[model samples]
Target: MIVLGVDPGSRVTGFGLVEKRGNRMACVHAGIIRPEKAACFQEKLHLLFRSLVAIIQEFQPSEMAIEDIFYAKNVKSALKLGHARGALLIAAAHCGVGIFEYTPLEIKKSVVGYGRGTKEQVQYMMKMILGIRGDLHLDATDALAAAVCHLNTASFRAAAHHAGGYAK
Candidate 1:
């Protein structure tokens, strides 16, 4: 199965596509979407939405995973993030891809073995786990980590179902 993970933001969004086969998982693509610097706020949102739609069309992932809304000290920052996330959700829904959300703590724990893992820890784990080569943006790596977490969760659920155990 292919999973698309996203780290949404108004100025810059990160995305990664991870494909799972048998016991192996690989990142097919990972990158950031940075709208032109001179663009207006609305244009940035539109760009994010349009870019993700193209990506979903290209990769055709079966599902998408993202970070859930977390408490923000700045209400304005939180609202902008919500808008960005809304664009991502709309993109996924438009493409008929299933969407799932994981809290930052859950994503960190799943990928770094610590609920409060630092961004560096997640970056390190993303490279080590996915065998990713070269450098990647912290945001991009975080996005890939989300995909890895989902793949792990899905595998566990499937195994439980196979053994007639609780899956959720």
Candidate 2:
């Protein structure tokens, strides 16, 4: 299964794609979608939407895993994130991709084996798991971690369903 994971931000959104075959996971691509500076809010949003739609088209992922909005002390930051997330969801929906939402805690635990793991810890585990070299800044790595989390969780759920048959 091909999974696209997104970490939404107004200034710079991070995305990563991974494919799972059998029990192995491999990275297809990972990068940040940065909006040009000095652009107005509306223009930046439009750029984000366009870039995300193009990414969906290019990757053609079967599923999209997005981080759920976490409460923030800064309301402005939270709202902007929500707007970016809305664009991401819309783009994925337009491509007929199923969307899966994972909380920050769930993502962290799946990636780092601890819910309160530090960013460095998560990044370390991401690199170790994917056998990636060099550095992946926190945002991008976090997005990758979200993808890994969803892949593991969704695979588990699928196996359980097959094992247990139908559950209402």
Candidate 3:
């Protein structure tokens, strides 16, 4: 199964793709999409939408996992994040990919074994889990973590079903 994970933001959106085969997972691609700083907010949204659509078309992922919005101190910042997430969701829907959303805490717990894990801890765990070398942007790593979290959840559900346990 191929999964695309997205970390939406008004300025820079991060994306990562992972392919899972059997019990192994590999990073297929990862990068960030940065809109022009000088551009208007609406233009930035358009740019993000177009870029995400292109990515969805190119990767052709079977599903998309996205980080859900967390409460922000600033209302404007939260609203901008909502807009960015909307664009990403629209792109995924248009590409006919299944979408799953996970909270930041859920992703952290799945990836780092702690719901309140620090960013550094999450990054270190991502490198360890993915066997990734070299530096990785924090946003990109978070996106990858989201994908990994989804894969883990799906695996658990499948195993439970096979065992005739609760699965939903």
Quantify all predictions' global Cα lDDT against the true fold: 0.92, 0.87, 0.91
Clashing pairs in 1: none
Per-residue lDDT of 98-154 in model 3, one digit per residue for the tens?
999999999999999889998788778878877888888888888889999999999
Q: Of models 1 and 3, which has the larger lDDT?
A: 1
In candidate 1, position 81 carries an lDDT of 93
By summed lDDT, which 10 consecutive residues of candidate 1 come out lowest? 40-49
Candidate 3 residue pairs that clash: none
Ranking of candidates on TM-score, top first:
1, 3, 2
Residue 166, candidate 1: C-alpha displacement in angstroms: 1.2
**lDDT (tens digit, per residue) of candidate 1 on 1-168:** 999999888887889999999999999999999989899878888888899999999999999998888899999999999999998899899999999999989899999999999988999999998898899999899899889999999999999999999988
**Could you give candidate 2's per-residue lDDT for residues 1-168 as a string of tens digits?**
889888888998888888888888878888898888899888888887888789889988899899999879999999989988998888889889899999889999999889989989988998888878888767778888888999898878888799996533
Off by over 4 Å in 2: 165-168
Query: Which candidate has the highest lDDT of all?
Result: 1
Off by over 4 Å in 3: none
Candidate 3 lDDT for residue 56? 86
Model 1 C-alpha lDDT versus the unseen true structure:
0.92
TM-score of each candidate structure, all chains considered together: 0.97, 0.94, 0.96
